[model samples]
Target chain A: MAAMIERINVLIQYKDLLRELVVRDVKLKYRRSFLGYLWSILSPLLIMIVMTIVFSQMFDRGIDNFPVYLLTGSALFEFVNSSTHMAMYSVLDNSALLKKIYVPKYIFTLAKITSSVVDLVFSMGALFLVMLVTRAHFSLYMLLIPVVVIQIYLFACGLGFLLSAANVFFRDVQYIYNAFTTAWMYLTPIFYPIEMLDKMEWVRWIITHLNPMYYYIQHFRDLVLYGRFTDAAIFWGGWLFSFVVLFIGLFVFKKTQDKFILYV
Target chain B: MSEEYIVDVENMTIRFNLASEKVDNLKEYFIKLIKHELMFQEFLALKDVNLKVKAGEAWGLIGINGSGKSTLLKAICGILKPYKGTIRTVGTIAPLIELGAGFDMNMTARENVFLNGTVLGHSRKFMQEHYDEIIGFAELENFQDVPIKNFSSGMQARLGFAIATMVKPDILVVDEILSVGDYQFQQKCYGRMNEMLQGGTTLLYVSHDINSVKDLCDHAIWLDHGVVKKSGLVEEVAAEYMNENR
Candidate 1:
């Protein structure tokens, strides 16, 4: 408990530095592009359009509001995808500064996650535009979107901590993660309906019961696309999975961080 | 942990394991570990070192290349953990070890000032208050909006030094940053160091210029291959170091 409090104090003390790092990341990410910040919204919109054209005809399985459904899953998964990838390299990228100064190492990973959160917010603008064009119902349940976002943020933070520390010792973690995320996206019901796996009951059970992203994406689709309240079990399950990963990530990261300077 | 000593290091040792082969990937490392084929040659960077610095003292560390001068400074600044023993330091430390290590090349000079300042643990309000002073000190008032990548190496170094020394830190760890800028700017940096030293800030400085070490430090330690060879008055240590080199 004392250790946890100390960590929080460090976070609060270095909060300003964290904000600066996030701003630098968000700015540099778009500085060279002609579209600049517009690409945040446009990139996801374009991806949604292409996916809709290619998959809509094949998996039209009587699902209502397919674009909104596809986008909610895509945007949420993209947040997890990009944030983890960025965080995995956060420690390695700042090896120069890390070797010289005493800034808390975890701050780099936190900044990457925060900046990706900022991008996720902008992508929501695209999601909203699509929802309006498709005339999807807007209900009070949409207010709970932030809750789902917080849960997934915790989940990604866990993975970020784990990956960033592991990357320092093994540079191959980044390439392996890239391939893993691609496979993970397919496993999650992003561009297709979950019912399509009805013939395989065990796979459906595993996805619903074991996959953390499935719960998050489903919670998101519930609030945003279906305009209905989520099941209490699903909500609690999301929090449980997120906290489990977060604690494990923090554990692995803390155990290995002291040796980072030597390797980095 | 005495209050009189602002910096205390006792029986500290730093070890580095030189891997026999570069096993960067996990698969090869695991395979080597399982087969008991992984070998590491132990290299001691600093062995059983002890030092204490009182408040308001400027101590110079003189050594040849790879004598573990930078390693000791890094250990004191809490950047590297001691492989054995303990290091205790009081108050905040501003490390100028390799200035501009935190600067993003693509960001403008003005943005880098705030970014680097925050990295050094200064609040935004503190940076905002000292923004004009930093820009003026670095003499880059005209190029504030230009990306730092376009700035000459000297200009970037100047900006880094200005921000780091803007506030009087309780402890300042400088590692050969004075060699970057022009002679005039080096003079300016020395002047700033003198001012801070007079204000009761403890300084741990590492530099190759023996003349500057003798000029700026009241006490000095000569390190030979991770061991303290001689220490005491700056004149004696500097004379002995120079005599041996000649």
Candidate 2:
């Protein structure tokens, strides 16, 4: 924990460096692409449309403006998903940075986590406009943004540190990691509301308690769409899990950082 | 009996575990993850190595490409850990292992220097205050605003080396980075080392340049297969290492 605190101080000290790296990362994907920034806005909208159609047809529920529901889930899940994926590879992607520079290793993941927030912020703006037109109430729970972002950020940073280390020695993690995200999405209560999980109490409880994404998305819905006030239990659960994942994630990265230069 | 010692490395060895798959593919990796048994084939990069250098001392590590010269430098800087033994250093340590690392190529030269300097452990205030001196040292005043991606590797090397060595650390770790800087700048670097020595900074330099080793180093160590094969005054140690290699 003392080490974690020291690393946090390092991140704060080098905040500008992290910001510069985040800007470069965001630009690299956009600049390399033909469409530039439009890809960020368009891709999520496109995925939401396809998901709405596909899932509506599969579930036989006529999709009932499922576009909005799918948009919310997609928006939230993509934020978490990209955050996690980037966090996992942040160390690997910045191996040169890792090898040469002597700062807290977590800053790499922190940069990724911050970049995920940027992506989230961009798409969520578009999501907000759509929700406004569709008459979804903008509840005060939306103030939960700061708290929820921390939840996702902590979990992402934790896994980012963990996966980046594994990636150094194992080349194949980047690929299997992609598939894991897809499967991981279904495990959380994202596309469908939690009420839909009424019949399967056991699965519902696990999704709520065990899945970190569940808290991330649920926290958002509780404040944004659901109109229900924040629950003490969910808030604390998310807080605790975030720190735990963060603790182990950073520990693994620091312990393994030395070996990366050799493996890479 | 020499009383002064700035860098002390005691019996350091580093071993790396080689995992099974050399190629990266999703299918094979997932399969291996499910197997529950991942055996690490191990190899040692460095073996028992020991040395001590005091304040104002300039030393060089010389070896062939595959020898653990870089590994030993990293160990001394505390960036790497040894499977056995201990490494101790006094004062703030800065490593110039690879020039232009942690530098975002997309950013302007000024921005990169700021971030790079910060990672190298200079405060933002210090970077700001010394900003002019830094640009002057790198000699990129005309193009400080330009992105480094557009610059040549030589330009990048000049800028990075200038920024790293700018700190004037008590203990400075230099690898083969001098090779990247051109002839004039190499002389400049030699001059810079002399200035640091005047200011009382200990130097640990690693290079293939026997001439530079003979000229700049007070002491030299010959590393062969990660062991300190020879250690003594620069001429004798370098002569022995160069003869053996030749």
lDDT per residue (tens digit) for residues B1-246 in model 1: 377899888889998888767677899999999998677788889988888889998899999999999999999989889999899999999998575688988899989988898888888888899999999999999999999889898998999899889899999988999998999999999999999999988888899998898778888888888888887788999999999999
Instruction: State the weakest 10-residue window (summed lDDT) of model 1 chain B.
Output: B16-25
lDDT of 1 by residue, A166-234 (tens): 999999998999899988988899988889889999988988898898999999998998889889988
Which residue pairs show backbone clashes in model 2?
A: A87-A160, A88-A160, B5-B54
How accurately is candidate 1 docked according to DockQ? 0.81
What is candidate 2's lDDT per residue for B175-202, written digit by digit as tens? 8888876799888988988888789888
Predicted model with the maximum DockQ: 1
* lDDT (tens digit, per residue) of candidate 2 on A32-149: 5788887777888777777766677655363344556666667778887777777777667677866664666667777887888888887877677668777877877687677887
RMSD of each: 1.2, 3.9
Residue B158's lDDT within candidate 2 is 82
Give every candidate's TM-score on chain A: 0.97, 0.85
Docking class of 2: acceptable
Q: What lDDT is obtained when candidate 2 is compared to the true structure?
A: 0.78
